[model samples]
Target: GAGVSQSPSNKVTEKGKDVELRCDPISGHTALYWYRQSLGQGLEFLIYFQGNSAPDKSGLPSDRFSAERTGGSVSTLTIQRTQQEDSAVYLCASSHGGTDYGYTFGSGTRLTVV
Candidate 1:
């Protein structure tokens, strides 16, 4: 894909269920990020992957949240034991690896935990 892509635009799951969100970054992009945004709330950084460096997991809210980038391209975010508080739009973004480069964001996956 020429731009960042995410799958299953919307998902509704029961509490305690697990969900996996996928992200396909633009070709050649070296930076990928995952963020969560609750209704009427601001974006919260979840994780970040850059080139061959170790992934930055500092932003993850809990051990149940995890993510991985494969071949420096596609990435997946997994949420275990979904909770009502975890309901939010998960956004994925890719960039060319610098502050000067603008990011291309996916439409985001809306997760609703009930």
Candidate 2:
């Protein structure tokens, strides 16, 4: 895809269920990021994967939240034991290795845990 592509633009899951969000970044991008924005709140960083380096998981709210980038192109975010508080728009962005070219964002996946 020319732009970042996200699957299941919207998702509704029961509490305690697990969900996986997928992101396919533009070809050649070396940096991928996951973030979430709750109602009326600013974006909260979740995780970051750069090149071949180990992912930065510091921003993950809990141990149940994790993400992985496969072959440096596609990424997936998994949330185990979803909670109502986890409902938010999960956004994916990709950059060309640094802040120089900025980032290309995908239409986020809106996850609603009920």
Candidate 3:
């Protein structure tokens, strides 16, 4: 991909259902991140994955939320047992290096839990 791309631009799921959001980042990028933005709120970091390193999961809101990057390229963010509070725009970004580098962000997936 030339830039970061996210799937399912909009998703509507029943409460308690699970959803998987995917992100395909630009080729050769080594760092990927997952974040969510609630209505009128700033972006909240959820997870970070760097090339072949253990991911940083500390920012995840709860155990139900988890993300993984496969082969240091495509990444998936899974939310199990979705709640109303989980409704938001989920964004993914990637960078050539780690946190120090500038990032390219995707359009984001809008998730609505009904």
Candidate 4:
């Protein structure tokens, strides 16, 4: 994909179920990030991967939230045992490196819990 790509632009799942979201970053980008946004709330950083080194996993909300980047290109975010409070827009973003470059974001996967 030329730009960031996210699957299942929208997802509706019952509480307690697990869901996985995918992200495809731009070609050659080494910095990948995930964020969660709730109504009236600004973007919350979830995690970041720089190259093939250890990712900056400082923003994951909980143990249930996890992500991985393979080939330093595509990535996936998995939310285990969803909760109603977990409903939000899961956004994926990527930058050229880690030096504050402009980030390109995915359209996002809107997850609705019930």
Question: All predictions: root-mean-square deviation over Cα?
Answer: 1.0, 1.0, 1.3, 1.2
lDDT of 3 by residue, 33-52 (tens): 99999999999999999899
Give the deviation of candidate 3 from the true structure as CA RMSD: 1.3
**Candidate 2 clashes between residue pairs 3 or more apart in a chain or in different chains:** none
Give stretches of model 2 more than 4 Å off: 98-101
lDDT against true structure, model 1:
0.94
Steric collisions counted per model = 0, 0, 0, 0
Better of 1 and 4 by lDDT: 1
Question: Over all chains combined, what TM-score does candidate 3 have?
Answer: 0.96
Candidate 4 global TM-score: 0.95
Candidate 4: pairs in clash: none
Off by over 4 Å in 3: 98-100
Score residue 88 of candidate 1 by CA lDDT.
96
- Candidate 4 lDDT over residue span 1-114, tens digit each: 688999889999999999999999998888999999998899999999988889989999899999999888889999999999999999999889867679999999999999
Identify the runs in model 1 with alpha carbons over 4 angstroms from their true place: none
Q: Lowest-lDDT window of 10 residues in candidate 1?
A: 94-103
